[model samples]
Target: MDDTPREEAGDEGAPPGGILDGTQEKSAQGGPPPPARSAPRRKPGKSRDHSAKRLANAGLAITAPTSRALGSTTIGGQLSAQLGTVAVSDTRGSVTQISYTATVSATNFTTTVGGNTSTISKPNISYWSGPATAVSGVGVFTPGQLAAANAIALTGSHTAFAVTSAVGNTSVSWNPTIIVRVPSSAAAGSYSGTITHSVA
Candidate 1:
């Protein structure tokens, strides 16, 4: 026998050799498993501002001339006085055939988130005679009646007559005057009125 241990080689009862329970094992140094793979952080919520804009109010105005005149006469003359017509003008001094007109304007605007808007209204006008109490008369005379009696000629007459007596001239004056009246019920704005006349 050799001095080394003898090799007892032949094991006749072991099953045929083959691989079993195969699996991979990671190394001990893989940087803590990639920090446990946390889900991505969510962004913070943001705030928004919402506000509305305001709108402006609307307005209107009306105006015209102060006075108007008719016809004239010369003294010491027997004549037929025909006082022509008097007319009332509009704000632009243009006579409107149908009726008067008013202009409303958007003087300002109120702004909002939606947009700008305007409000509007109309002006009013009132009319009255300056002298509310004035005299009006009519006379009827037959032909040749004046020659048979003492009669007074008249001024501002529908018939042919001469201006004779100077008394009560101020009251007898044919100038028809009118006054513009604005009522308390009227809106906060300007207004206008007119007087119209005709010759007979």
Candidate 2:
């Protein structure tokens, strides 16, 4: 018997005679194997819906001095008698002139007057004075009618009088008064006039 063993042939279910094929097959012969299949892609989830809403809220609330009268309540009276007064004097027996101060006070008054009611919710009072005049030696001094230098200065010390009530309750009151002085040159005479007061 020969000593050499039989060589394996290709396709005989046996090893090839050479060690192994070194060159790679070209795609033209059988083409590279199909590329690996990838898993199906998933779609992105929908974004969260964002919508604005309008809201509203509502709430509601409801909210709301001094001169003397010359006559009686039924009529009127000198409102400043007790609160104010005037005085005069002569020095050397020479003719002198003097002027009296006029003052008005309101007791129960309001910012707005509707018939008998006032719009003022609280009580308030004010006072005012007129300008002063000088007396000359042996000369006459007559106090001019108390005129409001301006609308604001008319009331003298107390310009506006406000109160919650009139006489009984005593909610509020203003007592405005004035005093007069006579110089050696002042004249004597009775001075009178109407002091106007408006509720409104």
Candidate 3:
């Protein structure tokens, strides 16, 4: 008889390849995979500016000629010398207020025949607008009987004034009438005085 021993099938342990789920078993020595890692995240903030600008302008025109003549009154004569208008525009984008003023360059009138011994003054300073669609009573200064130019205050203290965007020429316009007086007991001579305009 042969002296060889026979072996059984369930001899040792689990299958050599690994469990059926299919992840190859790590060698006993190798460590578990590093914990799952994910990228970092962030949140963001805000910014800005607010402001504005200004613009304005104005001008004067004599609707009537610059040269005017006056007639003498037996007692105190009154004559209209010149007629004119002023236009103001405000693009400043705000409601602005505007006013007018005037001054004589010379303190008094100068004439050939003993210039009337007096400071620059007028008898009447009347203001009116158009014959078409006039705006009445926007008057400045006084009229009739010895109006003084000895520093007249028809002019406002403010050099620059405000003009609202709503005001149109239809609303207001300047038409000044300068009247002079020569009392019966006055000097006999041809006198001349310059009426100047100043704005505020």
Candidate 4:
């Protein structure tokens, strides 16, 4: 019998260490495979800023009698026309002051009947400020204070009157009185005239 070692039957084509298929190769230094390199992260973008603004304004209005008729009067007697309440409103900004003006159309009342002219001179018209109100600001009635005793006179020329020293919206109301003193020798036949009131 031959004494030579016998070769393994089906192992002739196998690799030296017999490594398995699908196994990953180890690092040469034997440490865990270097962590898989990751893609670099991006720095955050720069931030930006973002705001708003407005202006102030104002307005005015008036409510009062547009016309009146004082009936017959005796010779040398006085005729009084009581025009109803006169109310003024000032709509303004928070820091704005309130004021207004008053005016009359003419100083004298004139009429002509059958080509004969008649005149009523020096017609007295006045206002007494009463019952005032204010909102959203202080109420300062300085140069515009009105009272019965300190009534303001209306004439042909425009006259400015302060309504309030306050810094916001304000309102003032009052009754107006017109007095006409008839002359002893005056000839009357239903006299008519106009009185105009204005505010600013």
On lDDT, the leading prediction is 4
Q: Which candidate's TM-score is highest?
A: 4
- Cα lDDT tens digits, model 2, 17-46, are 211101110111112357799856666784
lDDT of each: 0.20, 0.24, 0.29, 0.45
Better of 1 and 4 by TM-score: 4
User: Candidate 2: deviation at residue 190, Å?
Assistant: 1.8
Model 1 has an lDDT value of 0.20
Q: Give the alpha carbon lDDT tens digit for every residue of 35-150 in model 3.
A: 78884443443322222211132332112223334333332444443334422222223233333322222113323324435222433223222122133222222211122232
The segments of candidate 2 whose C-alpha lies over 4 angstroms from its true place after superposition are: 1-158, 163-171, 182-185
Compared with the true structure, what per-residue lDDT tens digits does model 1 show for residues 109-143? 11121243211111211111122122222211111
Candidate 3 segments whose C-alpha is farther than 4 A from its true place: 1-65, 89-107, 114-172
Error of 2 at 102 (Å): 17
TM-scores, all candidates, are 0.17, 0.20, 0.36, 0.54
Report the Cα RMSD per candidate: 51.7, 54.2, 48.7, 48.1
lDDT of 4 at 40: 66
Clashing pairs in 1: 53-112, 53-113, 54-110, 54-111, 55-110, 56-110, 58-119
- Model 1 spans > 4 angstroms off: 1-173
